[model samples]
Target chain A: MAHDAAAGAQPDPSSGGWSREVDLPSERGASRLVMEELLEQLGHHGWEPTDIFGIHLAVEEAIVNAIVHGNKLDPAKTVRVSCAVTPQMARIEITDAGVGFDPAAVPDCTRDERLEVPSGRGVMLMRSFMTTIAYNARGNSVLLEKQRAPHAG
Target chain B: MTAHRRIDTSKVGEVTVVRFIDKKILDEASIQELGAELFGLVEQLNRKSILLNFADVEFLSSAALGKLITLDRKVKTAKGRLKMSNIRPEILEVFQITKLNKVFDIRGDEAEAIAAFQ
Candidate 1:
């Protein structure tokens, strides 16, 4: 509980929206269940299925980048997720306990020959799904923001 | 073993149909599990031609996308074909964004994916 920095801050449960810091272990399996719970909460707030799916996938990518690529899947290292959601938008920030990276250094997997490569597309997928995205100066943290679709109620 | 349970396979004529038993492919362990199963399909089973159905899937991590690409190459090296079918609109959007829609033989139905083999 020592690292539960988000423990003190919680969204009003009645609002149907949520804001909190969730401690994510670097292990692979536990994170998916946590991701689902977050999306389910957003779904209750009237986010469209597509919107929920997009944000969910983008969120997973960010977490994976943190847990695996950033922290090298070290179980001792934990990933921290700060998430806020409303019917109109969702913002998520993932911070890893590892060194950062340069976005420009990632190669383009969309090129004709590179399409089969096993990596390098996670960041691109994040960029595509999120309305806006950024990384911290240390490169270990990524912020992903997605706006709710205008037509979605 | 849980990852093994996540994917189910069936056959439609000469084409092998691979579908995820889970609704989401966002878990890292599942990705590694699928990777191994797909490799076995290409190397050991000698069943390289595949049609992956995404009708049951709603969400998948970018890590899953990279694994799919790796499987695509494995099947190709085995001289087999891989086609995708029944992808939900949102999942399709992810492919379109990465332009991977251009890389694999994507079809709308099992019949079309099977027909592509002929």
Candidate 2:
């Protein structure tokens, strides 16, 4: 479950970046390993603390949504994650094996009536932290991209 | 005087001041445990006022936010008040982004939050 740069995770020397693709089981607490590895890669690439925080939050939300909401924590289901990180940007794609969902159906948690709802803020947080968040037609796969700040890069 | 593995709690006058033990509150199991402990304060002990201090917390995800929201509801149902303080700028942004800032009574520090309970 431990993913380090040396053990299968690829570091692109030519591009001065790191990229990794892995399949994580649909289980609670499965995203910790990937988040640690991704954060390490971001730090190695000189991402600022603020930027790292946002990236970490956004990525965590995406993976959790994939595992819990999309996959429904089915042991048979797996979440496929692809991450690419550089000083300039970080891009992550996560896909889960499930029925998927409609992003439009999610209520606006920020609205006055829904403000007190205990759930449904994951998508909003992902979109706010990452520069761009896109979901495929199936809505089971999400791509999160964070463009590094000018000063941080 | 409940034992908590994921958080630390203390008494501040009538308010139960709580602090997180983990820097990153991302995982599901821990967040669940945290929710249990927080809910215990209102549902079990019947504490009327609570203040959660987040000085040691560096990262928070939507799951953790869900727990906090649920805890807020529990406190309200018990006719109590829940407040949070000492959140770092980055984590504070998470609240602002979700607009939970409007849902919870967030203060600048432990002292301010405890005083607000008065």
**Mind giving the per-residue lDDT tens digits that candidate 1 earns over B1-118?**
2235667888888888888887877667777877788777777788867889888987777778888888888888878888999998888888898888988788998788788888
User: How large an RMSD does model 2 have?
Assistant: 2.3
Best by TM-score: 2
**Cα lDDT listed for each candidate:** 0.81, 0.88
Ten contiguous residues minimizing lDDT sum, candidate 1 chain B: B1-10
In order, the B-chain TM-scores come to 0.92, 0.97
Evaluate model 2: give its TM-score. 0.94
lDDT of 2 by residue, B52-102 (tens): 999999888888998999999999999899999999999899898888899
In candidate 1, the residue pairs with backbone N, CA or C atoms under 3 Å apart (3 or more residues apart, or in different chains) clash, namely none
Question: TM-score, each model?
Answer: 0.89, 0.94
i-RMS for every candidate (Å) is 1.4, 0.8
